[model samples]
Target: MNENLRCADEARTASVVELAQELIRRPSRGGIDPYGPVLGVLEEWLDARELPHRRLRDAAGAPVGLLVEVPGGRPGPWWTLDACLDTAPYGDETAWTFPPACGDVADGRLRGRGAADSKLAAAMFCHIAADLAPRAHELAGGLAVLLDVDEHTGGFGGARAYLADPHAARPAGVMIGYPGIDEVVVGGRGLWRATITVHAPSGHSGSRSTTVGAVTRGAHLVRLLDAADLPGGDDGSGFPLPPKLTVTAFHGGQGFSATPDRVDIHVDIRTTPGFDAHAAETLVREAVTALDTALPAPLPTAVTPVAAWPPFRLAEDAQPAAALLGAAAKAGLTVRAKTAGPSNIGNLLAGEGIPATAGFGVPYEGLHGIDERAHLAELPQVYAVYQRAVLELLGR
Candidate 1:
């Protein structure tokens, strides 16, 4: 980049960090109304800049997504940069060394819940749009910054909202601002998150028949699922990561005294393209049925589908990936394509045939856990990467 652009980016870093901090202060947990107050920050920023953007709403009139466009200096193909307003829940607050929502800057890190997970990138995208707005005609096509609200729950609803928009051109490609700044995420494992509700008869804790109660049955099932060697080979064997399945949540027991009448277990299965969610669901049902019958334990069980996203893979030679890689190279940053564990909105975008949908963002720590943070000093470079990516993708 030229010294002028460098100076401009330097001037914007503080505001970017400030914006990220402000966003972190808002708690947009997973739900239908995720963007309620959180999106106001973006709206105010755009309003202050006199930039044109639109607010997307669900049927209930809640803000679900924000779309802002910066026309290029010249005509090139359209591209989008993706980020989300929602952050994973700050689980077990007592476990954090710092308050989860305070958004304090410490030891060159921004200590907050959503900082690393996405807020940092969201703030940077806004700055990128601002920077590019002045020289719009110098580039080809345009830039679309999509700050979505419904990513943490699963990237489905927010994606649907954006794709269904008639006014905006479906982006030729997408760049997801996610973690793994060192790696360009070319693909990720398929994922299925669902609820398994066990319908076991309530029995007293004082029972001497040695039969396990509902909670016990749930535990046993969890253990069974964990220990069982289920089938499904890895899709991309060359990639370092492989398929995985885990019981994310186990909720049961009404009280300490009485035997729990029901148990709800949330299962998350991550796979390479080889594993089909329907097939996985069948396996889970078969396992539960076999255990319920052979173990003489639970009376009944039911599986309810929650969410399923197929694995996403961008071709190695895709233009967006090439642009991103070139941008990283130009920025004097070393980056290679790899698969990340967490699934993002790319699954939906890639499924929709955006050939180059991929995840890229600033590096951070403690994602979805206590003391979650984003590297404060890395904000500028993140901007540079995105700027380079946008230029490469949209340059005339």
Candidate 2:
């Protein structure tokens, strides 16, 4: 490894550790507004480094994005490294071994909510750009770092807003800093969030023969859904894509004494590459319609889509994918390309014709769960791999 590059890696690791702590200190739960201090700290760091950056804002004037651009001397492709600023709510803080925001460096690990999920990647990207600045004039392309504020809920607003900006230059390719060690993730699963509402006329429970209970109808629908089998496979190799359905929330009934007139079942559907949200919704609606026919009293049913994220798959032969493999090898890291289990902003970028991948950050387990943490020692290696990946994609 180059000595200067090694030094830059070490500095990046330490900086990300500190930055992760700073981000965790702010309660930037999804849907909740991000704390200004967190954005200010990141901006201040960029400004001090003399990096040209812009704050992407929404109509409400909320800070939705942070973009830093590293210009290249020669005209060429622009590459983007993106990370989300928002994190899931800290559940059961008492379950944590240390405070989520302590930014504590203990036993060669940094423990926090956003530590591994994305904040570490965001900080590391910044450091990598700074280190590459000395050689910017020799590089073949420009690099941009995009820090999005809304990812935990869905990246639709934050990501779409940035991509739609008239002044924003669309990069030839994008590398998303999700958690995946030095491995390149070339594909991701799709997401469909919808609510199945069952409705019936309210009546006395004693007269069950005349009145149809909404809760009962909802239960039937759930059973039908649970019993329904979607397409999936169990390829014993690794990370085989599987279809999943979950009832995240359910509510109905106004009072204990009355038969509930309405019941709502929130459904979360994860589909493979070939599945479309419209088709999935249609299947569910068909199931509900069939259930209504069998009921004693007719019950109205509807499937309402709350959000949809399409699945994305990039061919292994694509230039960006090939470049990632080559870069990882050059950086002395063994790499494999795979699909992500959950939906990510990579889906959006891939849809836009920018062959994108996720998992350019430090590897960590237990994401969105208690005891979330990232390996402190491995981040430098990840940074090196990403640095090489960017150079390879830009043909430097």
Candidate 3:
């Protein structure tokens, strides 16, 4: 068990670190983004290594993602390792102490936009594949490394597109490299988005006979939703997950004088397993309809479903989770597991019934905020966890 997965010595470690820095230097917004200088650099690196892979493309011939495969000498299920390629936009240049795209390694940190949110782990996975390629015969199964875009913007188009690609490997299990180094996230909250549109006859604010103003009524509905006792209320008797409801956007009244006739209130709700997106929508519509009884005159209201995605949860007995926990125990690292928050890709996989999926990676802070950073020295430990997890899950 002491067989170290930190196979990269000083020079190799330096090389991987350098590659990660170079990747951070390039800016990739998302799948729809036309600018992808990072992809070119990655392609060159893969070419030099002569790795077997494919560029997943959309119908219009645009690159959505890259899937690299290393086949094992023996037969076993394929394990898909993922780290998103697209990094969130660096908010303000002046806010950053170190230049966001400089990819500087200073103050004991790899400082850049994607330094933690995950270009580092992506680099580590590529290097791991290089290390494992020559020793493929020793592995009991094959491996596919997926570096994707379309995660940050919540489209998850990269994963969806790649899943449809005929050449893409159908992963028997999956691993995502995210921030929390000392944690292995087991699942995430689900999301439901909808708009409540109100249609009422317009009138002058001074002479309106309307009992409930459009904006005021919308506000009232917001309070109702917030106060409603939804399931998964941290009771500890259930799943220990809480429901989330928020009025993201409210539009009504123009020029601030005339009594507004139409109003639209947009809401984004997060749900747990017992309370799903569909269930949330139903409850909201029913409550909205019930509000009519309290009104002096019924104002027609419509609740339109914008979009929805179910939450993802992996059972404790799932193979990928077991492999990760076992490796962590062997490494003597205390790692906690829980469902963190809202996610798109994990939900997609979980909805599709893919339970053998888990997430773990190097620690970092300020995700989607200023001055994001992660420790290069910690890469070896985390890499060891990934390598061990892979071997434990895919090798046997």
Candidate 4:
């Protein structure tokens, strides 16, 4: 390696690790901790570097995240690099070998909650933006770093705010910095999430009278849902995976004294391009209708759709995907493109007709679980790959 490039990588290593540790120590668990302190640390870093950045907020004026952009001298399409600063709640603090916010760099791993799931990527992208700022005039297109604080909460307020901004240029493509070095996530199965309310006659359990309870009806419905068939694998839709359904949550009943009148079931269906959200909803509704007919509830079961996102799969030659994949090869890394089983922000962007490459970074362990940490041994290589990809996209 050239001396200058080696020095740059070393500097990036120190900066990224230091910043990631600082942010991790602040504990910005999504919807749990206030975003101010964590976002403040990042903003301070940007400010120190004199990078142009701004805070994104939701409709209620809550800070959603931060956006940093380095515009080029010439006009070209904008590209985005995204990573979430918010983290999943630390499941059991006592179960952790170290503090959830330990921020330790022992055994070649950065130990912490958001370190893997992605505060480290957030730190890396910030430095990438800073690196581009000096040579912004030499590039063709611009680079944007989106540090999302509302990601793990499922609100996606940060991405929404940025896309909704009238003045903000629509990104040509987006690369979400989710961790996992083996594959670059090019697409994901979209989801149709809904709540089903099962109704039954409420009565005192002691009174008997052969009254059917909501619990009984709900249990029956669960079985029916489980038996319901989804589209089998590879329906020739160009997507490799098939549709899936899961009854995620069920709530009903109180003390044994009384039979509950209503039960709510949360259903999550993973959709593919061939069987989209509408198809999933239809299948679910059919199951509910069958339940209503056989069980004969006091009122027909209610199926209310809460959220839906259409599935997307980027072609191998697709923009951003091609650029990133090529860059990885150029970096002498054999990273393959993958379609994740679970939906991500990439699905959301696909809804707006934007393509994205998600989940390419350092290897991780215990993501969203106990002892979450990102292995730092591959940090330099991962960093170099992304840097090369961004530069290639920017036509540098």
Task: Write down the lDDT of every candidate, Cα atoms only.
Answer: 0.79, 0.76, 0.76, 0.92
Residue pairs in steric clash, candidate 2?
none
lDDT of 2 by residue, 162-274 (tens): 78888777888778888866568888877788988898888877774766588888888888888776766853323368767788888997656789888999998886655
Off by over 4 Å in 3: 1-7, 31-35, 203-212, 232-238, 295-299, 356-358
Model 1 over residues 1-396: C-alpha lDDT tens digits? 699977876779888988989998988877734476788988999999977788876666767789898877665678988888888887898988988889889999988988887888888888888888888878889898888887787644566787888888788888888876788887776777789987666777777756667787788889888876655444444544566789999888875667887889999887565566876787688778876886564357888888887777776578788888877888888888876677767766766877554666777899888888888666677678778878777763
Cα lDDT over the full model 2: 0.76
Model number with the top lDDT: 4
Stretches off by above 4 angstroms in model 1 are 1-6, 27-36, 72-76, 90-107, 203-220, 231-240, 255-261, 295-300, 355-358
Report the C-alpha lDDT of model 4 over 1-396, residue by residue, as the tens digit. 699988978888998999999999999999999999999999899999999899999999999989998998887899999999999999989999999998889899999999998999999999889888999999987998998999999989999999997867789999999999889999999999999999999999989478678999999999999999887978888898988999999999988889999999999999998899889989989999898888897699999999999899898798899988888888888899999999999999999999999989999999999999999988988888888889988987
Candidate 1 yields a Cα-based lDDT of 0.79
How well is each residue in 249-318 modelled by candidate 3, as lDDT tens digits?
8898998557777789898988777778878988888768765545423456888887787777676668
> How would you order the candidates by TM-score, starting with the best?
4, 2, 3, 1
**Candidate 1 root-mean-square deviation in Å:** 3.4
User: Judged by lDDT relative to the true structure, which candidate is superior, 3 or 4?
Assistant: 4
Per-residue lDDT, model 1, residue 257, is 64
Ten-residue region with minimum lDDT total, candidate 3? 1-10
TM-score of each: 0.85, 0.90, 0.90, 0.98
Estimate candidate 4's alpha-carbon lDDT, on a 0 to 1 scale: 0.92
